[model samples]
Target: MALFLLICLVLTARLWSQDDPWDVASLRAIEDSATYAQQVGRADQIGFSLGQQPFIANVLIWDQEGTLLYPTSDGFTPIRYELTALRIKEIETSRASAERPFWAPFDHRATKLLTCLHEANICLIYRRAELEQELGLESDALAKVTEPDRTALLAVMSLAVVITGAALLWGLRPARPAPAAFELIADQFIARRGDLTVELTARDVAILDVLMKRDGAVVTKDDLYNVGWGRDFMPNSRALDQHMINLRQKLDPDKSRPHLIHTVRGIGYRLEV
Candidate 1:
């Protein structure tokens, strides 16, 4: 899950970096094309310089209200939308015609940019960012990653996953023969190690099973919740701790050498074999 989030953040950053050139171009486009002196209270563009710049696209500026400061030709209507932090907003792009592609409510990823025209109410909207996978990079990087590099990256990731899985499996390999005379009589819900005997409930057995399966390592609270309740862990719940305290008292009636079921501070409990 951490790895997944890291990958997502990296992907998001790369996508954001692609907008550097386009942002400058679009903002310049907005600034130069301003008909209102030094900026007024509405969204408008002054330039007729479309199809000229490589980075800039069909620029359209609008105020908080969806009124087009610069009128648009071809079937394009400004639908009311609330502007927030997300750079891209889904807007409807449809014609009044009943043709195959010119139907109603065609969703387009609109790039709504906050320009310096006003107190930041004026915004320049475009469908520029969704043009490609990685915006300004080489096309071959997206389609074909030069074979060798792609193969190497995949190989490293696979090796990492395999090593991680093996380490976890080796560490969590369950202690066999019932933790040295701490015998669990499953049918009776009773555990016995020498003179000490601990009676367990079904839930206690489930939780202990999960902990014992980890050999001697600390069993996480979340993992215990998963095995014990068959549900996600709730942070507010103290049931696991209470159960472990009771089980520990039963397991260590005399509290002899090498503590059984020792709490690892913020983590869960660990048992000595």
Candidate 2:
């Protein structure tokens, strides 16, 4: 399950990286602006609309005969020459339509879109950034860019479903059944549930036997001492406690919370299962 999620994550990243960052919506917006500029004709309206779009760097207006009407200055001389050359070529060929917009390379950072208005008898030029900013507005731009990557979207959704399913399966899994019983065989203590066993000292075995016989009932300290030391060689309370500590540690290293042997406070200890 983990491996599948990892594979999906890697595949999703690859698909996302392969997606195109540019969208046609940006081009459509630019085309509409250029068409409107040519229809308005007034320099003020055209300039105002152009100024509103931060993506547009400059504009050029050309008459039907390919004469530069706007930007009287020689600043865009190279671009003007290219536009006229293309216009003249189109005119000579008589193949290109005047109603639709034409695309031409501007430079490394920008491109030029020429939209010719047949009724107005003039062509509107727009020098726009390669990545148009008008339509690239955070979430809206991301949605437009990723909408075409259906494969990547599907991979992400599948990963979410798999993770949810794994969590559900884990939560619904059956609990492990507790050990049925325990028995002492020589120096080894064994649980009936499985082959789980632990080696024990003679005193540890005797002390455990007494507790096991009483089951969950408390076995007193005197009883444990008699069984562990046989009265004649009985040790002090601290010694018996130290032996019990060692026994509990051997049974379960986490003596702070012993599962098999539980301390019964003041009295003695009891065996649970």
Candidate 3:
């Protein structure tokens, strides 16, 4: 019962953490209105082309001189005092927006971004609700989710987050045993695998050294060839392959399961010990 209550509490907390759909709808409406306003501004030269054209009919367009451009239906009613309200909303939005677009993202100062045709210094205002339809928005701004649906959503999302975090932590955790460490002493070379040691020829050690430096990453044919032979590598040279074969034979005691000096078919070789 306690676990069930705890889960319910977590679910409730998560739901609370989400932005209200109404708020999201309002922001989306504003952004869409701004985009459409920009398009309309580009269409007309005098800044007001094709009737009293504003893509979002609910929006109020204003000029730099604090004159209302669209909704000429109202004649010339300059609402400059509304600038204080718009400025306040702008400051709040800029403050609330997070760095990531996915989480709690709002627009850059709505007032600043909504302003189009700066030559005319025209700006726009979008209200939350409009009974009429829009190009890319729902008929209503309110998104109503049932209680059961919200519960299901919260459960699924919580599980997904937990799974993703676990996967990342597991991937980043330290690898076991680590890569085999190699050392050369006179004629012979030695590689240590925890408690055990594998011995090889000096030439084999030289080839292995290149692969070790790469830290389990595949070493190119050219690199292996060059390191194995003194001069520049040639496509025909099989010297590197011969040495690697000898190294692999010596390293793998079972000879069935290859764990060190892997041949990558056509490309190159990789070491795993």
Better of 2 and 3 by lDDT: 2
Give each model a TM-score.
0.33, 0.31, 0.32
Q: Clashing residue pairs, candidate 3?
A: none
Q: Model 2 off-target regions past 4 Å?
A: 1-181, 187-195, 254-258
Ranked by lDDT from best down, the candidates are 2, 3, 1
Encode model 2's per-residue lDDT on 221-247: one tens digit a residue.
Answer: 888889988888655889888988777
lDDT for every model? 0.41, 0.46, 0.41
lDDT of 3: 0.41
lDDT of 3 by residue, 1-273 (tens): 323433444445445444544333333433444443454334332223212322322234444454545434333322211233444334223222312111111122121122122222223433212212333446443322212225454343221122232233234333444344444343457765544567766667778788877654557788876777645546554766776666776665655442666664445776644
Evaluated at residue 167, the lDDT of candidate 1 is 32
Give per-residue CA lDDT, model 1, range 53-105, as digits (tens).
Answer: 21232333444464444323323322222222222222111111111111011
Candidate 1, which ten residues in sequence have the lowest lDDT sum? 96-105
Q: Distance (Å) between predicted and true CA of 166, model 3? A: 9.8
How does model 3 score by TM-score?
Answer: 0.32
| Cα error, candidate 1, residue 41 (Å) | 54
Q: How many clashing residue pairs are found in candidate 2?
A: 0
